[model samples]
Target: FADLKRDRHDDETINTVFRSVHSIKGGAGAFGHERLQHFSHHYETLLDLIRNGTLPLSEPLIDLIVAAFDTLADHVI
Candidate 1:
């Protein structure tokens, strides 16, 4: 989130986040963290779309991403 906030088009940060969330999602499901797994799945989907160019990286979208990042922290800890 910090890196992406500094540069919304930061592909490295985006990829890192995607991979991190993907692992979280997998671990969540395996360990019975259903809510986190569900949330991360959707979040991961959004990141996937952004990385694949299916979703445009607009300021508003970045804003949503930032907000979601905050919510994800709550889910994680």
Candidate 2:
């Protein structure tokens, strides 16, 4: 995900990162991790915005997502 913040418009980077989070969210929900599911839901929403182009991919946005990912990861662990 560090690679995402480095490039503002790397489409592959965007898709890959979004998929990673979405998959994590889905897996967490399936495993009954409510805290992770809740946190990931918000992250997934942001990723959906980016994936759908509703939110333009930018350094700041990616940085924010990365920070959110850190928080989510902490909770999951």
TM-score of each: 0.86, 0.78
- Residues 1-77, candidate 2: write the lDDT tens digits: 86775574566776776777788889998999888877788888888888788988767877798899888777767
Q: Which candidate has the top score in TM-score? A: 1
Off by over 4 Å in 2: none
lDDT of 1 by residue, 1-77 (tens): 66565673578778988898899899999999999999999999999999998997877878888788788877787
Clashes of 1: 0
Clashing pairs in 2: none
Enumerate clash totals for all models, in the order shown.
0, 0
lDDT at position 47, candidate 2: 84
lDDT of 2: 0.79
Candidate 2 lands at a TM-score of 0.78
